[model samples]
Target: MVVDSRSRTRASIVESAAKLLREQGADAVTTRAVAQAAGMQAPTIYRFFEDKEALLDAVAEHVFATYVSSKTLAEDSGDPVADLRAGWDAHIDFGLTNAALFGLLIDPARGGGSPAAAAGLAVLQARVRRVAAIGRLRVPERRAVELIHAAGTGAVLTLLATPPQQRDPGLSAAMYDAVLRAILTDAPALPTGDATAAAVAFRAVAPQLTGLSDAERSLLAEWLDRAAGAV
Candidate 1:
């Protein structure tokens, strides 16, 4: 089938580009190089991708999608906070292991529209939601998500900028702990005196408030979110 053949060709091109990126870094992934690696003409690459940037985008999405797939397939350990920590560790490891691809994925211009990046963020959002549901989250779910995402990104970029031998191995763990202290509570349940924690916990269950109409539920969620973020 023509469609199947096209799909295979596209996949081969992307895989070849990914290989170049991983082994030799992004500078080595030119159209000529990728085409030679894929055993095709450079013109064939144009048939598949608009330009070098487009090809790089494909490579980023392909590699990041594979990583996201693995994360999605992992079983949750039942402890939401522990699960979040595991996700953070995995993210840092991925960034270190795939330095070129991670750099591409984190670029503001390209990453803004990337489906793979969005999928990764969705995974983080789910993890944060679970934490909020269990009453451990002290901030709003969105705030918690933003804080964790920013911290993880900053940690990876910082580590990548440092020489490997000179990098502090404890930096990532320390950053995670600092983020936890900012966004989470010591108690497993909502504490009576902590209005922010109560608001966050309530926001977690706001969707399931079936007795309220949809508009009422939305309004309640808005109020709770505002209250949670007030701290």
Candidate 2:
């Protein structure tokens, strides 16, 4: 019973903090303000969170987890490239809609060890893996993942810095296209004479290579990844 009560209280505090963050931005999420919003004393927040930063971390994770859940719930469209584009669109929309939370999630100091941020990256990696498996990825999976992630972050930060009325609506799409061209091949299957694409295709299937020891598989993956990155 005590555990349940504590969980409820913690959840209430996080929800209240999330609401403040969503509506009024991060500056408005002071402990005193959050406590008042949650109908509790400021000290009660200390009982649940170590400091304002900790509370904000919880709020970020809570909100981002909800958003991630929505992404996971959606049915995949069977086209890996199209599915990746959809994920990118959703990411941009989420960043725009939750500016304060997005800012918090992207902060290098805090985001480095954040589970929420890691989960988001994992989703991107899965999408990239799907593309690699289909022989469309030209670069290594890790390289493709990094390029897409960096581009998306740059696009969101750029748009957020610009005044709403002055922002270019085509900027995100253009960035995605540029990233796709860098990381993906025109052909749906691995093209002959394209060493990078062939390496990437082989890397994608390395895990399922039969008759190979685990260490052998790992070495093969490393070699293939290096070959893909060389191009």
Clashes per candidate, residues 3 or more apart or on different chains: 0, 0
TM-score of each: 0.96, 0.94
Clashes of 1: 0
Decoy 1 TM-score against native:
0.96
Worst 10 residues of 1 by lDDT: 222-231
**Per-residue lDDT of model 2, residues 134-201, tens digit only:** 88988888888889899999999999999999999999999999999999999987688788888887
Quality of model 2 by C-alpha lDDT: 0.90
For model 2, state the Cα shift of residue 57 in Å.
1.0
All candidates: CA RMSD in angstroms? 1.4, 1.6
Best by lDDT: 1
